[model samples]
Target chain A: MDKKISVKVCLGTTCFVMGSSNLQELIETVPAKYGDRVEVSGVPCLGLCSIDWEFSKAPYVKVDDEVIKEATVEKVLKAIDEKLNK
Target chain B: MAMNTSTPKQTSHLKREILVRLIKAYLSDDFAENTRLIPYDMRPKGSEVPYRCCIHSERAILRDRAIAGLGFSIEETEDSTLLSELANKAEKRDVPEQQPLTVLTTACKGCVPSRVYVTDLCQGCVARPCVNTCKFGAISIQNGKSVIDPAKCKNCGMCVQVCPYQAIQKIIVPCESACPVGAIAKDENGHAKIDFEKCISCGKCASACPFGAVHEKSQIIDVLKNIKAGKKVIAMIAPAMIGQLPCTAQQLKEAIMKLGFADVYEVAQGADITTKNEAEEFEERLMKGAEFMTTSCCAGYNELVDRHIPEMKPFRSDTKTPMYYTAEIVKKEHPDAVTVFFSPCVAKKREALNNPNTDYVLNYEEVGAWFIALGIQVTECEGKEFKTESSAEGRNFCVTGGVAKAVQTLLPEDLPTHPVVIDGLTKQSVRDLKKYAKNGVCDLGNLIEIMACTGGCLGGNSTVNAMKPALKQVTSYVNSSKSIKEQVSGTEQVKQ
Candidate 1:
């Protein structure tokens, strides 16, 4: 059995303001074969905004504990692909 | 001087977010139970106030915004019911009025009247040209400055012109300044009021108002209700929706289908037909020795001509809009289906009101919110490759000069067709159009293309992205399409 990938999206105000409100929708379009293996959840403020690093931006997403910043639909999909292939 | 940067863009985004959430809630099974508490849930007592004086006022404004989103204008009613109650009543109504735009008085800052005022630069010139220019004794020397009497001043700006120091400055209300036809004015209470009779529903005022007092009444709830009732809702996607979402047009279609829309059709298909028909009409008109002809694709420009420039009406091409043609095709294919034109302009909302073929209009912003609320990621969706026979020229109709270019391409190479493209409508452009209308012909061009919004439909008020990038995306998309010959052949095959 394939291990399920848990994906957490930051719903912080900063992230929401940055147009991350619709990132959850990306979960719905996962191919039917990988549907069960993917789990998507919305988490309030992953606290990425508080970080001082330049790479740490709002709209942070964590896929199986791997944090991705400035996440777009394509970027998140690519991340999911990497996880599924691994 | 306000600390809040409540620009019109931010205000529009905020309103769209609330509406999206509300629509999502309405679609849920537990909608009836939780409908009343949406405003409070969105804005709690302890939450930070973004725009208004306090959290309560902010919540109140949100409630009113949500009400406007649900397609009902908030009248000055004596009923003291909660906003949720009003939403409940609004949701149950069969259909909303045809009023496309409304003013949220609660959100209005009630700005000062638009007038010309004296500034500190007033040198109290010995010449006193300001006083001489004023036919009425409105200007007077007071405290080493030229003061204009508010009652006597006609706001004619003659004093502004005559003053060599340029001391006089015009303080314009943002909404009033944005309106091309002077339709928006202050009511007795100083709140921004829209005169529906004079308003062209161009949505310029809505985009111009810093307070975001003016709003386009949405038809999302009505569309949702129809979908919930198990009706086949066909989405006629406009050409302007090319790069609005973070997905290709094919992927966007698949995502829309996921939202319970029976199917999706591109309005560019209609644009192809319009191009052919309009080109033929143009040639016929020119042969008959008629003056220059204008493109009729822009509903805002059409409304402007209808309302203001009456003489120009005769010269406008009598071609039905792309949405009209597309909706007709949808109706022919599925007689039972309700056709909703997914547009990128506010004027189309008003256009849809009079159009029997198109049942409803949803702007790109509302559609984006809907996608977000439904958790339908268009970019992630496997693109459903529907065969499109639309030409590059037809698909280019979303940008400035696209219509003229398309028509010019269809015309014979030898024809004397000089195209004049009005990239954006301003007071100056309107004056030029009026000049052409009065003079019958201008040396500039015999074929005129007037786009109300700068950069055409991509720069429409409801568009999500800025103009420059969106234009690039649209141009690339158009370039990628099939040639005009191939498209015409495919369209003919479809008709047969």
Candidate 2:
């Protein structure tokens, strides 16, 4: 019931190698500012490129239902900042 | 002064231009003189794996015919520029070209009329029959007039027909009428269904599908893992990749490295090797009384033969494709490293997976999608040099006759032999080749180089963008690089 935002990263062959797995490690153990409202997870290929874009780009991650490109620790945090009010 | 229709001189000049452009686009062969050929002991173990360097040999003929249709001369310099300019007009020229209507019905809703063009003659019919016939009750009378209930009407034409006035028009979407293949079938809800079997994968439907529901597959997820693993990943790039990418080949390689691949290698380099080996193999085959020899570089062409010309199976040369061959060498050198093949062909998916050496194979279309999915703009990575071995012969593998040109280096100086090169292997051409093989009347001199698609890998089904000019650009790019000696030496700034 707590208002926790979950970030799921695709560790499929493309994402994991493009540093998605590493990015997930970076996302874990959040800073004090966000407190316990955030959580991170790793998932399989969401078929984003396959069904949505068709291998035009990659290194993607998803926050709940939204997709983020060029997935990195900085970008994911920035995305988390935009969605949540400080 | 005669508006010269029969200008053989002009036509021959134009033909040269076309061939040059084609040579640039296909970029099939390089290193016609010197390159290592694969040893016979390492040939692919199963029939599932393609053994020939030539794919779709018939398609080469299509490219030749397309070039011949222009009536240009190979000897003319000016014709070279013109042909190169138009070499990859396949999809470009086809943009305005529409598909037939039967296929169109698969995706389109029936035409709807633009504003009710009700005639002035719509008299206040005493019967009120038109309004009564409207099932949806779309027609309604305005003011004192007996106007139909427009909102309730389903636009079934029942109202229009009921009205003695005859007033109704429809607007249609051109896309719905363009697909000749019934692959694009409509659903009960009016969306489209893409039957893969029915679909020729011609992409006409994707182009025409206004909603953009149908699309090519993506392989970004697969590519990302190799980059992050931090292994010595070598990207074996297809020759057509030279100019088509927004950045130069070096820059694209740099961008890929920035994303984290260990190194980049050109598959054309493998072609340089393949050409020499296959030429030698062809000679040996002829010596052994093997009357017919077909190049097998093209996976689709191989599939075509397997599916259509089972009898011609013996004619296909037993050489692994350049991609596979190069992967094999890389695999041997860096036992722990992974190799990724970046090609313009979709069938390469099948090719890469089957090759024990190729860790992964993703076409240009899939890579393009991955770029979008990752939000990595290739332009941002521009100007970065993606380091590679300098090999001119390997780089020229992007065009038609490239294999033949490359193999010519292996042929003896005075061998009295004639080899035929076929481009764009269509269904008809394969049948023709079979006929020639069966009749023993083939003038190919027992050796035929076949590319399944029109421009070989440049014309593969999975490519993300146009590949014509890219072929020429890569050839020049290859020419600027060091000779084949620099590729295998692995001494060009080798990093542990």
Candidate 3:
């Protein structure tokens, strides 16, 4: 089965400042791990920061429509794992 | 903007988040009211207090952060003071504080006092080298395990060096360990406190704290208020611009202009002036039989001399900084314009306050916040070409060995100028400088260049990029620019 999982890493100011810069590594690692099964790209802003403004779980990333808050390499990779397995 | 330190700490991210939010609030409709809502907005009623123990404690820390952001003294402010009131006061503030750093008392971890510890690896050997090596009897064998008495231990770390098993280790407070001047320490409450009298304003402690507690009193409100009032705010961008945003210099210029800056002048132009004058001064000093002279561009180094090593005053160069010369040129040309310098560290903020030509200072972090607040992408900006381009030497001033090399290139072939670079200031380097000053001669080299940050300005506390990438970008800029030797000769030919 050729599964298509699209991951959009939020590069917005809030996300970037909230340690999303570290997640940029996932842009490379995701493709290396999942091969053609996943497509990774950096998006400007998820616009979820203001929506989640009260408790800024900034640096959000979307893995196949699933928003990952307080994102990390491990968290992003785990999300990719669940989606791939699903 | 996001930074890419080899080990990017969460504290830096937390600090940036607060700055971005504060800038967003300031740009919003109701500055005072909105600024007050920051902590509540960030840590609303049911948020998981990720950092601190409780939501209330987290909010207290955020409140203190807001106080620092509004350019107020965190130590001086009463706990009862509301953020809304401070915002109003900040809006009307005419001048910034002289001290550049403020500690968030609630956020400081109040780390256990640094002491020599005997780890589990300790064999409790019969030689008892550790006990013997310790000048102070702080270590003793207890139940076949080495034990250290906190009160008796001087934290000298001699025992750590002598341990054969290497089981002994010294635990240090990051802020206290990073400070070269011994300016910051734990107070009665165990919260970090800075002795401003001894602080070199290097911002080492500000960047060192893991809790992101130390804050720079920002004049962002002052700069924004002027820009909002239709003042002609001209940005004097430092040589580190290329190392900041991912964009061409021309494009970065356009992006700065997009954010209400009437114009942008590369501080490198001022650095060129600094280079020429400093070269002349060095030659003059060398010819006068002086043994050596140090470069005077690093603001942190200048402050270190003023506060801690006054004896080195004579050997230090008296030339003004690049920001100074840049602001001078801007004022000379546009007398009515308000000058704002884009700096990479906190020392420049203190430096700008002293210079009449400079009106305000913004770190790379603040400028990044401003860009975010305005939703401006530098990479997408239309490139604006500069009328007069700077020499490679001027552009590379932010790099270690840049100033020394720039000066060395300008001297006559027979001048015998040997340049030595002090990569970064530390307790050892500070002691060496004092010794050099006391002896009135340096055997290492006749010309010494000392940069406070390890990799020069690119490694500054507030820089958004990592060392390798920043250096790569800056090197590209330097390679494309004309060399200083040719530029200097061209200018002299024109004058003749």
Candidate 4:
């Protein structure tokens, strides 16, 4: 019951306008399972637009300190699942 | 409508309204040739016309100066007083009228000839060096006196430099030369004056002037008015604003909230919505064989259309930019909420005015003033209210490929697609867009997303932070968020 995770999403224009902006909102509405651990906020521009090769590869975020380059809710759940298991 | 015979004064008022409308039409391009024939009633009538004191009305000496600066001729008559009244709309007005640069036109006898004021310091010491240096053959020794010919001499400073007496006079200043818009020029007393029309408000001349003659008008008082009213005020910030100050985003949000904004919303949130909408729009347009399309988000690009490429108007989308959309949503939810967009670009000011919902657009430089007036120390505003946007795709509106990235995220995984993102829309970039739009000739993609600014929003003309670091900060922010790392970030994603 002591599970709380800090989820920082780049709300910079590049991130927010892409899908991450919506993703940050989505995180707040996420089912009770991972909702409480997700602390979402918008930061300034981060240089991910440089490394982003594919459109699908972006609008990214991080859990704790690990970078999740591809922004997909399933990938986030996977990462969170691994952490919970550990 | 018939006028009552007893109300002669009311009829004159009606005529004034009609005259104002005619003047407006005359100043517009739509009536360039047919202005004389166009009736005044059709034009915006009455006190609706913005007015200010005629620049030349103050003095006859500066009349030509204003005319030359405005690139228009002025006809002065006994009715010039009425003309000034019309120009100023002093009697009846709603919006702030444009105050024309006040010039002493009555005193100016047109442009003064450079030779008229030549000093008598010609030593006449028989060296004849001054006469020899004259390229125009204007300088000569007449009756043992060095004289300059008014007709033959150019305003070139050669005569002034050669004279041992150092009597040559030049009215021009270095700051005036540096101004690309011709905004700065010498006043009646040879002091500097700024013409806001030609000025892009770039602040270049302000820095160039050794005398510090120019500074931007501050709107801190207006911002404070909204705060004091206790109406909900929000700061919708641009994405490139990251790392601008030493404080964290949370700290900054806290500081802004303390300054009296009921909430702090990220403009990135709007970008997310735009990305979602634009990506779909592009997919549909491309598949429907709309061969060439341009991004409509950039105000400069929109201006280019209105000024240079009116033919491409059909290609432009009606969808508003992210900032406008975000402000619209905020106003919709909170009708009383005054939205102030914090952007790096001055064009955003123009855009904000055009946007129906946005109340104000403050450049990053104004943020310091806003904080100072509120007595809020940004660094000391501990903790954050946690203002966040929708998704990582939404957050991508800041950089060059942001739109494309959002589109890609929205695309169904199994769809075979060649989506191309055209970054940094220069003239060359448009050529590239045409090449990609070619059917079967270019395999780049049917779907293309274009951004006019280099490096995208981060590279906007108004941002305070450099694009490189801002981009990095965005990336780091994205990498740190939890929901974007998961697959179900969107409601649509959940259904999928």
Name the candidate that leads on DockQ.
3
Worst 10 residues of 2 chain A by lDDT: A49-58
lDDT of 4: 0.51
TM-score of 1: 0.82
lDDT value, candidate 2, whole model: 0.53
- Can you write out model 2's per-residue Cα lDDT over B354-448, one digit (the tens) per residue? 67787666555445434433445454455555334536766666677666666665567676556777876544675687797677557656567
Once fitted onto the true fold, the runs of candidate 2 whose alpha carbons sit more than 4 angstroms away are: A1-86, B1-215, B226-232, B372-390, B444-446, B482-496
- Candidate 3's displacement at residue B371, Å, is 1.3
Off by over 4 Å in 1: A1-86, B1-8, B76-81, B121-133, B161-166, B489-496
Q: Residue B484 CA error for candidate 2 (Å)?
A: 5.7
Error of 1 at A52 (Å): 25
Model 1 clashes, total count = 2
Itemize residue pairs with steric clashes in candidate 3.
none
Query: Candidate 3: misplaced stretches above 4 Å?
Result: A1-68, A73-86, B1-6, B493-496
How high is the lDDT of residue B72 in model 3?
89
Q: Compared with the true structure, what per-residue lDDT tens digits does model 3 show for residues B1-496?
A: 4222334777766666677778888888888888888888878899888877899988888889889888988999999999999999998989888898998877776475566788999998999998898788888899998999988988899989989999999988778888999999887777889999999899988888877778888888999999999999999999986776556799988988999999999999888888888888899998999999999999999999999888899899888888888898899899999999999999998898799999999888788877766667666678999867899999999998998988887888899898999988889999999999999999999999999988889878887765665788899999999998888767762210
Residue A9 of model 1 has an lDDT of 74
Question: TM-score for all predictions?
Answer: 0.82, 0.49, 0.91, 0.48
Local distance difference test values of all predictions, in order: 0.77, 0.53, 0.84, 0.51
Candidate 2, residue B65: lDDT = 29
Candidate 2: CAPRI quality band: incorrect
> What CAPRI class is candidate 1?
incorrect
